[model samples]
Target: MTTTDTTATGLAHGWYALSLLHGRIEAHIERALQSGHDLSVREYSLLDVLSHQHNDEGGHLRMNQVADAVVLSQSATTRLVTRLEDRGLLSRYLCATDRRGIYTDVTDAGLALLAEARPTHDAALREALDRANEDPRLTPLVAAVEKLDGGPKAS
Candidate 1:
């Protein structure tokens, strides 16, 4: 299904079609992620952030930072983390200097989950990339997206 043919399908139109397409892809991947790794896609994304946090000292990242990275609200992120912690997938630590500040880190179990999920995740990503590459218009579309990314900062 092409995005340009907005009215071609009876059930889809323009942005609705785009959103539906996105939803379908996400649902497929989400189910696969949960069944294969015992982790949701959102959980995997959060774990990814934590794994990268090792360079930031304490092997942790602030909850807010993780929420932004995962595109989830603070409350939603908190709930997800709590669930993962209950499953022994991760741990949340309170910052010593600021009692109100919280950081999250991936536990050994979480790392294992990530390791198990990597292959499935990679395969899904590769499939999406292949689909994109098969479209002749993608080259110009990618060029437009790159241009819209803007150049270096103004000094």
Candidate 2:
């Protein structure tokens, strides 16, 4: 059935539209980053978090903290971090004060990759968003997306 028919049958149209928009945007960004930089969106997001944490916790975060920040389960975060570590993008270190805790820090290579991926990711997102905004039916949803992005609303 068509989306309009589903919406007419009592589906929440706004949420359905938002979900579709989110998936499309995510897929676009994922593909762009993967083809351009050999990075997944999750990996890029993890590196971005690390790159911005230089002033806090000595530029490192406990594995649990990284998991929380990245919205991944601890095990998933560990696996992802391990993969990045294997690639020399990040390192895991034993915490000096707390033997039970391990910290993850971005390596120089991670920073370099993030630097290269940032522009590609940003351009892909902007292109996808602009395409979404071009759809007249998505006007309100586009405005909501922009507001969430801290951008000025279209009048």
Candidate 3:
């Protein structure tokens, strides 16, 4: 029915607002990434995770760990990793210490791609926030989102 009518049902209003905000932001970011970098949101997310884990010696994470961090199913994560590996964005290697464990690490190409996509992602998020600010009803929801540490900031 009406917005007020929905809110009268209790805290469902806040949850609904958050879900709406999440969906809008996700769609905007997905579009921006796809058009600007030819990368899907999940692909970018996986690369982002690996990038953050990068270090002097080259950081890596187990497939299960990556799946958990990205909130994807194990099979889905494996497929995503395979795609990235095929694109030369990342590599999967058997762990020397534990043969059964495989580590996925970002390749130089992935880092460069991530560097390129960072601006687009940041701009999309900022635009979403700006649009949210335009709607008085979204003020609190936006504030809550702003407080969370989503990930690496765009430089």
Candidate 4:
């Protein structure tokens, strides 16, 4: 005697599919990063936020602001920042206007690190793109993701 609901099974399959997709992509990124960069995914995301912050400003961001941008807990962000700071990739300075706030700025060392890592990152992205191209089913999924990710609309 078996007890299985068709609708519930279908829903479970859908969830499993999404989870598998997420896991595969994350693992691919991890493997690619391991080959060329010293950063974990979270750390790389923080660096990305800092790079954009520098681009938008003279080159500094509040520590809290970075924590918010990266969606990390305050204490976790602080620890991550401390690690980067110790590596000379970034600096933390007392905010002159608000003594309670700390400002973070990427050092020249960080910029050089970004420069050195960009090519490997780009290559990894290209490899992913190539893999996607080889899979016909993924084309529609990619299109959907692009739309959700804010890509330009097709005519």
TM-score of each: 0.69, 0.81, 0.84, 0.71
- The alpha-carbon deviation from the true structure for residue 42 of candidate 2, after best TM-score superposition, in angstroms, is 0.6
Q: Which stretches of candidate 4 lie over 4 Å from their true place?
A: 1-16, 54-60, 129-139, 147-155
Q: What lDDT score is found at residue 73 in candidate 1?
A: 99
Q: Rank the candidates by TM-score, best first.
A: 3, 2, 4, 1
lDDT of 2 at 54: 65
Question: How well is each residue in 54-95 modelled by candidate 4, as lDDT tens digits?
Answer: 434345677777888988888999999899889898887776
lDDT of candidate 1? 0.73
Candidate 3 residue pairs that clash: none
lDDT of 4 at 4: 67
Superposed by TM-score, candidate 4 places the C-alpha of residue 141 at a distance from the truth, in angstroms, of 3.3
> Residue 97 of model 3: what lDDT?
72
Q: What does candidate 3's lDDT look like per residue over 1-155, in tens digits?
A: 88887778657777788788888888999999999999989999999998878544536677888999998999999999999899999988887778997888889999999999999999998899878867777888888778885779989
Off by over 4 Å in 1: 1-21, 55-59, 129-155
**Per-residue lDDT of candidate 2, residues 76-102 (tens digit):** 998999999999999877878788978
Q: Write down the lDDT of every candidate, Cα atoms only.
A: 0.73, 0.86, 0.87, 0.71
Indicate the worst ten consecutive residues by lDDT in candidate 3.
53-62
Residue 99 shift from truth in candidate 4, angstroms: 1.3
lDDT of 2 at 25: 85
